[model samples]
Target: MVQTFLPHPPGARLALEDATRARTGSPVQMGLDELGTPLSQTTFVVVDLETTGGSPTSSEITEIGAVKVRGGEVLGEFQTLVDPGSPVPPMITVLTGITDAMLVGAPRIGEVLPAFLEFAQLGAGTVLVAHNAPFDVGFLRAAADRMSLPWPRVQVVDTVKLARRVVTRDEAPNNKLGTLAALFGATVTPDHRALHDARATVDVLHALLARMGPLGVTHLEDLVTASDPVPHQRRRKSHLAEHLPGGPGVYQFLGPRREVLYVGTAVDIRRRVRSYFTAAEKRRRIGEMVDLAEEVRAVPCTTALEASVRELRLIAEHDPPYNRRSRRPERRPWVRLTDEAFPRLTIVRQVTPDDDAIGPFSSRRAAEECVEAIQEAFALRRCTPRLPRLARAGASACVLAEIGRCGAPCTGAQDVPSYAVVAGAVRACLREDAEPVVAAVHARIATLAVQERFEEAAVQRDRLRSFLVAARRTQRLRPLWRCPELVAARRAADGGWELVLARYGRLAGTCLVPRGVDPMPAVEALVATGEVVAAPTTAMGAASSEETELLADWIEDPATRLVRWDESDTPLACPVRGAARHAVPARG
Candidate 1:
């Protein structure tokens, strides 16, 4: 039989009880203020179980007890004993006072599970609460699976986890159910009986709920995640996320003076921004950023890809203090062929339309390493001074000529045509073909290893790897940069079409077509209204290399379909494969 009680007398309301009741409506509301159902209106089914063993696999449920309550009022209760299909262990019987003889006519788990599930009302927005939830829930889930009974998905709250967050060590020895029951002055004393223990847990649940108000946990969602306590300072700033839309977008945390402190992208802007003020955000730097943030601004987009591209662009534009990556696009180094009588590979901070370049390497050090690799593979001139088109009469070669590392065009020893051959090879390696350079470096590494010069071989291997990786990136990006415009579509996770228009390796526009709708109209509209990206004057393209790389990744996805391609002399393709096979040195 079900028992009932009212923990709070009529008209005796707690601090936030009235406010919580007024705001309690639909749990599906997306506003930060309306975060799930208010705790006052949430139905909590406090459950406890007596088991034959600790593990669900080896153990069986001996009894089940639960009390369903809402607004400090008991709605109902469930209590039942189960025959474990075997004699109870003496140790378990001694702990719970249930002996083998007591299970003679008790119903089996299959017969009792349906009634208990009905009492809990698990499918209709009711939450399941337990002291140590995993143990009790694990046993029930295992029993249901064994009987082939469908288990409804339900939100579970663990009082043990909640008490640890709310009740300090000074107030309670530990977060054990018995200790918490005593600390909260529970009316029912637990004596290992399922119904009695579940009764004690109801008082503990209400007492814990009363203490959570000052911690800014008024909603049922907040209470479930209360174990990860949010600082009072961060919790106060949660209102900043209230107005943000619940959609794919880019969000910027603005400082007191409205300066961007951090930029991020998320599929759900409201939920993701709200996480910054919670324990979900564990980065110390971001935590500090949140403390200083005065407002949050969102830029909604149609698809996740657009959000990602917008995030990269915003990061580059603001160079926010908290963002470390993709902040300074201008500072990225590139390895390019300098235009001169004898062109040499030089690391530059910028790339021009006339230049043939291979990078946008991560740093100047990496660019230098790539240049060293190219020099090791070819006889390109290393001299910094530009030589005359015709070799001068009094020119003298540097020590590099004696070592035969350079063609020595400065000494008039090597004519313009011979030097041109070397410069052309370097250009080809940078722009068109990387195999010759890769092969030359691989051969050098093999020869070094044969002579027991393993260290030198390893250095050659590293140099080649740097060059090949940069070459592969450049080869992949160049085609997209040269293409005037390309439109593509792919099936999204929601069974809809994701249409994108890219111009000169930059994301011009994106649109999402609903599942049952024809996407051709959306594709046409996207292309018509997209940004008009002009032909890039520089090899770096209209967008930053990082932005271009993001676009390239989307275009190269196997599931993406190319709807249209307006090529500019070069088709979209990577001519050379990666150098992973040749990157390792041969061991002696």
Candidate 2:
């Protein structure tokens, strides 16, 4: 049977239950009020344990002490000597001042653990406090495991972790229990015994609490989050994540009028969004975005990649104020193969219906660099603007012809039929075979090296690398765009497969296969229920380059596994001999 106790002054012993309460109607409700429970109202069980050794698995607890407090009043205290069922090492005996003889007739851990659990009120609204909690808790858990007893699910506060966040090195020499105990001027000094050390930790706890108040640490969650020290703006928006579900998904921060301010993905949305309100969130723009956020909305996805795709799509659609890359595909430059008799490689902001485009490159400068590399690699016509057949036949060859950079197509010197051979090589390079262009660039680099133009050769080498990187990126992604319909699956982080269906290169459906379950049913259900977003119908849709490029990017990730494609005759796979492998810097 458990004995009842009432709150009392510091160092006061537990009071006996009143006999008058037996005559009363019912047992008085002992719970504290729920609305914003103050630190004064919340009970703290400051705990300390003396163990035979550090490793809980190999060691055993020799003694345990805890002081229960509420509003700084001593509610109760528990102290016990435990029979560890093992020999105490000599060093442990010297350090803790505990010996095997003292525990000769003490209660075993099985009897001690349950009684201590009851005394500490191990349930909701109660928090466990310790100087170095992990050490004590580890032993407690080990004892519980040994007895086949369930450890209480209680919130634990490590004063050491808290002290590091709140106390500066200048204020305290170190965060050790003894140093902090003396620094805070506790009522009892810690002397290796359990109860005395617990009393000291209580004083340190109150000192840290006082320091935390000025720093806007009000709620328990705030107190816990203070350990990381996130941006100041994050604290003001802590309520934004109050209702977010903890799951894999995309989260959108919305401004006034429901305008999206930012879009992101997280394996655990609640934790990720709450992290923004902590000091650990260091992104400068995201901090500003959090300040502007009025509401947050979470959309759960089947897998991380699905969440990633959804985030990218939302970012593309809303062009959220804080998002930087992948926001405006229309503005991103593409490598355009002009539809002229003597076609020239050029970088354009948008792809036209008639143009044979190769990119939705990251930037205009990058696209220009790729065009330059391709021009160096192949003898494509270097003339700008459309070249008429008649004009090309009459025009004089430029000085570039003397350097062998071009086939002199502006003049009749190189006939259209003869020049088509080099043009065919350019076409093949753009379509898939990047080997010819890569080889040409290598040859040029070697020639420049032979001429002792090392700096120029380095520039050529960098250009070749840039060209190959872009070519490989586009090459990897191009097939996903070309396919009419596709089904693919990739292992989700949660030990399941994430299935995705695309129609005309746009995401049509997605679903998850729970662990240990067949995925085919979910895949069929998703395909049946999912909506096919119509592709852009303007010159944009005619290009089919941007959407396809995005799809290719998602598919290129090594984790993604393709299950099916619409064109069975044309399987979707990486090119056997593409520029991807050629771009690697050779080992010396």
Candidate 3:
């Protein structure tokens, strides 16, 4: 997702240069500010294609025409006839005034496509415009793909969509190229030929943009967004995003009683929050969520990672009605080593204080895979929950026990003292010492491959990879538990720094330092106002692995600089030989 954010302050409208500078260091930030890019600076490529027939798959490009312009001045032009490699239909010839003789010696589509692509991308940033964008762009993409050429990543604008949004039917009879050209009094009229139609569409594009100027559609992104039709009822509530800050932050949609409806994070809170009310919002449930929302709230953060972590925390805290995922944290399954006489591995939701838990995995299946990998490493009991206290004297043993895959404590075939060593090794593997389990899994994978059971081997490989990822994540985060205070800084776009302070892995306070500002006073003020977060008492809520991982990611970002810490040494460092790093190899 290409997330967008405004600059430093949340509520202030920024000048183009200022907004650009503010978002410089952040990767997710993109130009969405209404006035960020001037109309005069943008390049527009008006394109039109006369194809053999309707479908690009069946029909081929008969002619290609385009005009490049910037600030109303035509910079260059492209026009070509393509040998479509098929007979041009009589109906298409009558409509476009191009016949077989006209294209007799013209370059084929394969030869024409590359030159067309180069022409379309003549400017630093180009937006392709057409009467009906999909038709022209579709044919171009189809022809390019047939030649095994990569399609250009250019923004496309449809004059039809633009006219539907900006001009009422009362002003224009209909949204056809000819009708629109006459209605807008365009000097160049559509003559059905590619070049003439493209020129006419160019005029229509300018006309639509002129109509959009009053709606605050100054930047290219703003223009594209405005072209989307928004629900009338929803448009009235767009005021909720009017004052949202432009920087990285989490935003919440609130209901009548200040209840959180949906929680989301964005690099540009205003742009993202405002999108919920637009026609581009296709999710039916989200439209329903917006209908219930009475207000929108913004909480600023220093970086994209911080926004993500804050979103997780907020979702967990509120368990909001509209939020479907991450709201029910208790529902996320974890792989736990049961605290019974035969300590078998199990997939569980509720985490008791005595249980050793590995994760709040995305699903029960993932947690099951982790447990299966651990069991494969050590022949732990694979019986159903709560096995007979001493195993029924004459009970039947399952195939797993017969195959030596399980210790078979359920059938009295294995004793508790003997099982203890396997369970202990499993615990060791789940914690830091993962070599024993890794080697065992590698051997199993090798044996399965030797037996030509490649599918089963792939499954085992994934399982082992899952266990290693969780175990390494836990080990890397273990040190943060001992630290009382942690503080770090990331450089801002304007030569300043943003500060983050956490106490015992919980975010406490944040402050920003402009390039030359004194840091001491602001630091003191921030710490004084910072809230003291209490540690989680429940095993399910312990450590908030998601937040810790987010923090670790933020700390590791190259833009950040360590400012101050209450501890003598920073415990947050990436492990050199961690299993997580070793699990995947870089492809050449």
Candidate 4:
């Protein structure tokens, strides 16, 4: 017969008694809690656990301590020191004061858990309480697992979390057991015993919960808890890595099949998927996202660009509940610079081949330098064309031309040469290729270093940065993982589309574009160049016209992908089905 300090009692009248029964009857569940809503027979089975070590997976429970509190009063308790079937570590011995010697003749967890669980069920609907419920809950689950038992669906309360909200995140002097005990005035005297810790946790919960008025800490059933609080620092209970696939894809979270909660992307699908579970609270954004999710699903793409295009496509296609930004096609700005006799900087709403003004500079200083560059290169006048009548025409060169900014363009001195200089600078600014600019800047900075002109060298550094910014404007916007030029077009046969590869210039190979992979749903042609710009279709009911899958086939090959943007010189790298260059008819 099972030995016990008290007689077994009948189940309570509340419905939640079923929950308590469920936990204990499941053979070996993590722990037991009183069931029932707060308004109906609200009470608590406050519990705590002392373990041989911090880890539940590797460590065993040395003791299980519990007590029942009803109507704001302690009803009864059952505390036991269990033989973990392993030697207690020295550190645990020092802290918990439980040793191999103390547990030599004690009942093993298997021998005593039934009686413990039975007593807990007697007060079913008792809200399980612990400083950090996960710690208690984890060991309980571990104990159940040791006996090949399933974890029960029992509720819990975490005083540690309660203190975070009930009191304040940072106001507490300490959240530790002793500190909390002191805060709640529950500590009779500090001691490191299992009963002492359990009792202290109860005190902390009692004090903290009482103070949580209007902050919603009243009801026991409504509070979230776990029998195990200090679970392992891992995503899965067993600490195994969440396996994921390595490919381009879009991922989604599901709460039952009806609710599509979150959507995300990854080039290496597995790494991205696994991150949701492994990310820590320190990564607030990701953690918050994961918390809202239940299950994950991914759709594979052959290439990163394909993944990207498909990712955007699916967001608009499905409109997953968790995505915050707009999924429809919209316009974003691009920086451009203009060419002039004395290059002037200006912003443009759009970029086309005919435009060569000064700057599409997102950075203001970069635009100013574009003006300075024109003046320095072509010796052009920086002064207004319409100057005051009071000043003589030949008195002095314009601001720039006068100060050797140009070869005196104000008085028409070296007008041809000055204009030529301006032309060179404008040309340099317009060149999207940055290698030349970086080389020149490096040479110039090196020259300044030789001259010991550190300040000038600093200016050169800034200038170089400006050059790089202009150079990388488009490059940075486009992910490097996408392959070269891929053309998704209407196929001649079945009215569907096929994505074709253009190696350098000519269409040579093709692949079937998968459904729902285009990021830009609308097909757009760059106004001046007649080249397709992947944009969402603005027309009503238009399937994303641009082919998103054309390049997926050739992305892995070295010889297929090429650059084809007619007006842009931005060297792009794509896997295969993207822009590629091939030899063409020589221009006149």
lDDT of 1 by residue, 322-418 (tens): 9989889878889999888778888898888668888888878778878988888788888788888778788888887889898788877888888
**Residue 127 in model 4: shift from native, Å?**
14
Off by over 4 Å in 2: 1-194, 206-224, 231-233, 255-258, 352-354, 391-394, 448-454, 489-497, 513-525, 533-564, 568-570, 581-588
Best by TM-score: 1
Question: Which residue pairs in candidate 1 collide?
Answer: none
Best by lDDT: 1
Q: What is the C-alpha lDDT of each candidate?
A: 0.81, 0.73, 0.74, 0.50
Clash pairs detected, candidate 2: 229-279, 230-278, 230-279
Q: In order, what is each prediction's RMSD in angstroms? A: 10.1, 13.7, 9.3, 17.8
Candidate 4 on 1-588: residue-level lDDT in tens? 111111012354322223224323533432122112442246667777788888888888788778777666777788888888899899988877888998888888887677777767634455667767787788887788888866556666677776765555466666777777766688554466666777777677667656643332233423442112222222331111122345455666655543666667787665556545432234555555555555565555434444555556566656766676434322322334444344444544445433543223544566555444333333334554542223446566655644555555445465444456555655554443334445556677689899999788777666655544444432332321122243334432333333333322222233343355441222222112222324322210112211222233343345443323332433444213111211111212
Model 2 residue 208 CA deviation (Å) reads 4.1
Once fitted onto the true fold, the runs of candidate 4 whose alpha carbons sit more than 4 angstroms away are 1-47, 50-101, 105-129, 132-158, 167-353, 369-381, 386-395, 398-404, 421-425, 433-440, 447-456, 474-588
TM-scores, all candidates, are 0.84, 0.68, 0.64, 0.41
**In candidate 2, what are the lDDT values of residues 58-122, reduced to their tens digit?**
88899999999988888999999999998889999999878889989999999999999989877
